[model samples]
Target: MSKKDKNSSNSRRDFMKTSATALAGFYIVPRHVLGGPGFIAPSDKLRVASVGVGGMGGGDVRGIYGTGKVDMIALCDVDDSRAKQSVEAHPKAKYYKDFRVMLENEENNIDAVSVSTPDHMHAVIAMMAMKMGKHVYVQKPMAHDIYEARMLTEAASKYKVVTQMGNQGSSGDGVRKMVEWYDAGLIGEATKVYSWTNRPVWPQGIPWPEKGQTPPKDLDWDLWLGTAPYKDYVENLVPFNWRGWWDYGTGALGDMACHIMEPPFRVLGLGYPKSAECSVGSVYVGEFQQGYFPESCPPSSHITLRFDRPGKEDLEFHWMDGGIQPTRPEELEANEQMGDGGNGVIIEGTKGKMMCSTYGINPQLLPTSKTKDINVPETLYRVPKGDQGHYANWVEACIGGYGSKEFDLLSSPFSVAGPLTESVLMGNLAIRSYDYRAPRKENQNQFDYPGRGIKLLWDGENMKITNFEPANQFVKRQYQGDYSL
Candidate 1:
């Protein structure tokens, strides 16, 4: 190895050794003792811990274990009931409800962490883990806001940690195929993209519950509200309904766009949107009146974002949710499924168009026959097991340690997921702005949505809305109490 390479390697080893000694009080197991007949050394096995092991979090923990190359060292979650399965499954693993406690105590033993919490807590949990020299695999949207995403993306490089976002489609072959096809000129110069989802399947567009139900006996309501402003426990907000609330969720666009729109984002080499505009659905309070719920996301929204491509022509991207869909392209066959029935994306260009369902699965060209006719070379490499390999890929990357080829090969590393998330949240900014209201001075009972009517201009670098001041508020949010980025 070159002298520089040797010095870097020694530096990393020295840091790990120094950190291990500093925390020996909490981590007493010897590396060699963890090795024995028919077993790899525990030091060699990537030691992984997880936060929020329920629902998708539960699935993430299992996926990482399924790789068989990692040691499950610890698990954390605010709700005891939700963490039951993971705790029962890993009998030897340490358990805790507070992530900060787990991290402080287990820092010497863990090589990486899986953050599968709600949207608002993602950045804080993952950022703290990354800062402590642990590789991180964080679930989608990356963060609750654009500014947080940008910060985590920059943090990934600064910390020199291996990182991956839980946008599994990023590891799928379909997206790679789309990228290669675009590079091959199969679709000419792309100019537009549309993505839609049938989501917010939970309650939205309603007022926050005025009264509190008794909090679940096994759940810590305040801890679950991490990073978001505190609120009295409401019925059905735990488990999954939180997606409808602005404080805890990023709405339907944040929940599904990462999976459905990733292929288009990857293929186009897109960046921040130059401007955004949106129209939202309204709930009826009476035959002639409409209800407004500022704390809840709209039931439906159609957002358009324009991008200034560096060398190519400007592009327009449309995002729809709450079962809204774009008009069918004339080139598609009448019988073909429109993006797996409930979720899908379509990219249009001068010569042709391409479409795919969530996770970038089932990709096909317009006319359907084009998929069979096209012979574009496979220039981009595919993950070993397509989307299923995403977990193992991150595990292996962590085992490869940081700065190795394996680390750099992660498909959805923060370097990429960060910007993708920021782009997706731009739509939410428009959706929220569509509902922004100030008291109408002439009428005390009514309000005017000053945030509407104009295209909200954006300055990506500065992370602000150049045209509308109120819309910029969604760019970054205030963290409550001890939680922060």
Candidate 2:
């Protein structure tokens, strides 16, 4: 076996040992001796804390509450006004305005934490939680930048904590069924994928707003900035509209790519992409077009990503925003219409085609005949039934439920990160590059960045561009303070 393979195997074994001892209610020594970071043992009812308890965080809390195996012990958010209703809902739970203070004060009380902050704050909060021996469920896109994603993945391994990315779609019945069908060869070699979303209900591309409005009393503007460079709080940027901006949000792609692309990324084992480039239409270029663009960044954008699959030929994945969808495939039957609203994914295989949406839940398979075929696989992969439930699957596994057969942290690899993040970042780069110029309908060989559209090679281990320097630089971001991932 290769040295890397040997190291990975060693890490898994160490994680299992540390996890087993913790589940048995033993101190298990410092995990440093076990070649992995230590974790706290499973305690009664699993005391839980929540960071960023608004927006998606509230939904996450509801899901965890659905499990009935956790107690809502604490809640944290920079915006007190947004969290006020949640705090009232969970009258028994303590509340805090900063995550750092919540983590330190509630260390012994919190067995796990649900991190539902914006993309930028995810890595920092999650890393701190795992270091404190708390199980973590971080919302998707996973990290603001590539470096942070790699760091979180590494920390999950090192800390031997039960970790779940809050892409809830990952736990759905249809998503697992899609993976099973692909594994059973329902469709031969998926070479191309098309995923799109109609997002940014908030304004886009508008120039930055003038400094006029006073900050809300319930909001702590400075704490909300966290690790990101400071900017004055504006009504356009806060509450729930940050996704359209450059600094705090990742636009439409970051908002929905994790849900739309989850199936294809999981089934094909498509790891990091080789390179990505983007082009967009002009309606969104103007500074004040329909007042959509936040005074901070572009209003609407489109991007196309070209990825090179190792040991296989190159693949092209296209993404569109502002209600754009792929040209209907000729092979699709008349009944197979791409539905309206939200996000969906269309995968074109050598043999046939498949499309799934609503985050792959209750998906519809096409060729109509394929749906009625009896020879097709019947047994779909399902998460095992348990007292802890689906949201707690990773946590239960950490407590040594099934020995070596338990869910391995590495089972779901970082394949989703490279392509998904690339697509999202491409939108940001395009808005910055072309200033949201007239949308380029035709695919071009050369993007403004030399070799931007060219097929490049990726070394996942080293997280480097074997061929393209510009693309490599795109993967790494400048850290603002002590935050280095």
Candidate 3:
């Protein structure tokens, strides 16, 4: 190895040795010698570094730090203005603009990483941390694409690292209750599931800006772009609104499905989808004039996915976004609210049905009255503090090390979240394919959307579309410059 590489490796080794001694040196002493039997030494706490410390990322930092078992050692974000709150809140944390630099310099000081970056950057940052043997807690959906999700899942095992996806609903009691109900046969065999959300609260189905503007002084536009293809800075793109664009975000499905669909996904033991098809709402510029904005996600969409179970028939799953919703179940009362009024889920079985709002909150059986009538023993373990315990779950697991009991209790480990994320991104694949345009064989001027009006068969193990080669583009995207899995 080169001299610099050797020296860096040596430094990391020395730091790790020192940290190990500090963490365990007192273990040899009696309980009373350390003040009390239940006392936790300061060195025993998990040290964490956060990336993209703004917006939802900031919330993640607070959740993890609030556990009181973690030390916020480092913070990183491309936008200083956006990260101001987190920076001021954790004044002791060493801050950096680029996560790459922070991870490189603080590799031995921190035991874990919290990645709350944009969808495109999640995989790259989390993958790097895992490769360095640092535990990782990544925001949902776990990755930007199916391939990245798969890789992150595999890396977690290969690296023997503790991992969790930021889908707090996985730890919610509502989902646990649903799981127990399904196991007790209250809902029978679920044949279909419907999930919807009134998302894209951000802009979507619109054309890209015609011109560029200078970025805010505190923002590092290039770093914010990360793995996405180069684009000139535009106003209102920072802090929010990136969700509508294909390059930096995964659209509405990516933003909400992890929380809304996770309950059913966990309750049903769902795997990769067998097939996917979708229809998108269009934007109209004038009377009878359709606006083609391929760069942005559609304003609305309804996606149908099929999954094959071992003994039963295929299960059909429907996803609706952009204020769209499934047909209200007759069992639901006319006056009662459905799925928190805006976002919710309904699992339909042969004999009955159950539903819940976002984050698996307020799960209920059909006929609302049946919710109280049917009671089943809780078979699944509930996470402490329910949904809010998600952060502490990861923190405790990191301190306990991989394969520990705490690690086994993680609600949304990469093993589970990876497949769930793949299922979520599968919807996006179909939606992007919906906008696929190719020249007609007979006419050079006309175009046809081949991806529409047909179902795309998927090979989950291979991560490919067996029926159409064109749709495979969405399975994995080209990483611009040095950014890659």
Taking all chains together, the TM-score of candidate 1 against the true structure is 0.89
**Ranked candidates, highest TM-score first:** 3, 1, 2
Clashes within 3 Å, all models in order: 0, 14, 0
Q: Which ten residues in a row have the lowest lDDT in candidate 1?
A: 12-21
Per-residue lDDT value at 263 in model 2: 66
Candidate 1 wrong stretches, greater than 4 Å: 1-43, 286-289, 434-447
lDDT (10s digit) by residue, model 3, range 1-485: 22432343233222211221232332333324555322333347888999988999999989999999889999999999989999999999999999999999999798889999988899999999998888899998889989999999999989999899999988888988887788789988899999999998999988789799999999999999989989999999887899899998989999999999888887777777889999888877654335546678889989999987756799999999999999999998899899999999999999999999999999999989998887687655567798988898788777666765566677888878888899899998887774434444434222234675789999887899899887898889999888877
lDDT of each: 0.82, 0.63, 0.84
Residue 122 lDDT in candidate 2: 87
**Over the stretch 1-485, how does candidate 1's per-residue lDDT look in tens digits?**
22432343233222211221332343334546654322223247888999999889999999999988888999999999999999999989999999999999998888789999999999999989989988899999789899999999889888878899999988888888887777788888998999999997998887788798888999998888878887899898999999999999989999999998888887776667788888888797654235657788989988898987655678999999999999998988788788898999999999899999999998898978878988886655567899999998788677655654466567888877877898899888877774434545434234345565678888876788987787877888898997776
Winner on lDDT between 2 and 3 is: 3
Q: Indicate which candidate wins on lDDT.
A: 3
The RMSD (Cα, Å) of candidate 2 is 6.8
Error of 1 at 409 (Å): 1.4
Cα error, residue 264 of model 3, in Å, equals 0.6
